[model samples]
Target: MLIRLLYASRAAEAVTHELIESILSESRSRNPALGITGILCYGADIYMQVLEGSREAVNKLYNEITCDARHRDVTVLHYEEICERRFAGWTMGQVNLAKINPSLLLKYSERPVLDPYAVSGLASVALLEELIATASIVCRP
Candidate 1:
């Protein structure tokens, strides 16, 4: 079974290259055989990441990430078994906080101290789909 965890970071631009590199390296090095994969997004003041793998591997990865200093205010979203993967194309794929959809972030939180559950949680998947579609439209010439 595959597990999916959605986490939000308290810092917006706090996710540095060094931090990303460290996460990627650790994820790959720690589970060289599990074939884990993920994607990261950063909005104005939050960081969201999706991790997928075997149940044990994904849980372990989540534990490691929670202990890391680079993140704060972590939240899990939509964890369940799936026959298909939304991010199976890369090994630890990470996108900087700047590339994420601002509207999605806005939907997720009005501000750090004022987070509304409707933005980036289980219900946020709908927002994510909307953002992706909007992004795809914007990227077109």
Candidate 2:
């Protein structure tokens, strides 16, 4: 069965471009073979990632993240079997939440920052959809 897992966590250390790049590099290299696809949204010290794939693969990845030293307060925002992937185009798409328009962020959350931990999973998913609609994500084919 296929599943989609949405989760959020705080960076254990200050977030940097290099750190994000390292994570994306690892994800892109590892995910496609596992039949996984998803988008990663990041800003400040927060991370929100969506992983879609077989139940086994997705679950394993989530578990790894939960135990990863780079993250803390790893909270699952959503998880469900899905008929199809909302993010099928990229191995691991990315969106820098800092670059997103403040107005768009405000539309989803109480403030202009993307705080997945403070909002419902549905709202976070909606924000991701909006990011896709606005061509905010960048990824490799």
Candidate 3:
């Protein structure tokens, strides 16, 4: 069965290009082999990612993410069996929230930041859709 899993976490330390690159590199390498596709959004020491793939693969990856040492306060925002992927253009696409206009963020949440912890999972998903519509997500690191 195909599944979609969305989760958010706060960086354990400073958010740097190296750290983001490292994560993207790993995702680009490993996700394709595992049949996972998704988008990653990062800013304000926050990370919000969505993984789409087979149920087992998505679940295992979520478990691994929860145990990863690079981030803390991992929280699942959404998970469901889906008929099709909302993000299928790349093995792992990315959005640098800092690079987007703060007004865009305000459209979804109270403030201009990625605080998935404070919003409904559906609201977060809506933000992802908006990102797709605006062509804000990048495929390469």
RMSD for all candidates, in order, please. 5.2, 0.8, 0.9
Report the candidate with higher TM-score, 1 versus 3: 3
Model 3 residue 25 lDDT? Answer: 95
The lDDT values for all models are 0.59, 0.94, 0.94
Superposing every Cα of model 3 onto the true structure, what RMSD results?
A: 0.9
Q: Stretches of candidate 1 above 4 Å error?
A: 28-32, 100-120, 127-141
**lDDT per residue, candidate 3, 70-106, as tens digits?**
9899999998999998887879999999999999999
Residue 2's lDDT within candidate 1 is 72
**Which rank order by lDDT, best down to worst?**
2, 3, 1
Q: In lDDT terms, which candidate is top?
A: 2
List TM-score per model, in order.
0.67, 0.98, 0.98
Each candidate structure's count of clashing pairs: 3, 0, 0
Candidate 1 clashing pairs, residues 3+ apart or interchain: 42-97, 107-119, 108-119
Model 3 earns a TM-score of 0.98
